[model samples]
Target: MTNSIIKSLSLPAPEEIEVAIRGQRALATYLSTRLETQKIAIQDADNNTHQIELPTSALTLLMTILGELAAGNAVQIVPVHAELTTQEAANILNVSRPHLVKLLEDGALPFHKTGRHRRVLFADLMKFKDQRDTNSQKAMQELSDLSQEIGLY
Candidate 1:
């Protein structure tokens, strides 16, 4: 995806948050069943009703997007196979571009050079992020345990 599209994912407005709350509730009602596909009827602004079949996976994704919007969070949907610039990857990781470059140089993250610029696979970036988060959580838990053992808590 283009940087413009990524940058455009701002927090939903108050009106949109209300709409997302309602929409998420409505959509979540259909997920109670273990069906492979869901048939949903939606009314348009003109009051015309149309039925559409949505895969369960797509329905779940929509629910997640709506949930984030309802909570006033910005969401960006990136394809797994997409190649992102270093800056874009840094933005996603909430880290500085220089830090990300250092990680790449240290072989902590996998990246490939496209022409003179470095490109990171979205999937690879996610994997690295997940690992980093897991490590952070583990360290936090260890610290908490140590504090408790030392009567610091």
Candidate 2:
């Protein structure tokens, strides 16, 4: 039998969160509290920047999530399409864009160009990422064995 979801744990509207935190704009205060309790990080462009020391956009996004939480709705969000440029895909893969372009050119991942713009599918990104993760695990095991044989720190 499927477990029934509790109403107390749900996400709400981003816009509503924005309105709720409008006046003081204490994004860090609000987010730190939520993040400390929840093992979730806000994937936001604004949160990546700190010169201003405030994540207005992230705040808005979180507000919506908090509102949903208050409303007792459970949801998990993911991208429908990768819709990323070569540079963006490289960033997602933590690799150089030139390398990603070469992979695309070599047919490693399915991608298409619209005029001059190239876009990669999210599914392809996920597949490549899984492969990379698996390879990393294999390499780590090999290195650990080598380290033990050599008695290297």
The model with the greatest lDDT is: 1
Please provide, for model 1 over 30-82, each residue's C-alpha lDDT reduced to its tens digit, 9 standing for 90 to 100.
68458889888989999999999988888899999999999999888888988
Off by over 4 Å in 1: 1-5
Per-candidate clashes come to 0, 11
Best by TM-score: 1
TM-score of each: 0.90, 0.47
lDDT of each: 0.89, 0.64
Error of 1 at 16 (Å): 0.8
Q: What is the C-alpha local distance difference test score of candidate 1?
A: 0.89
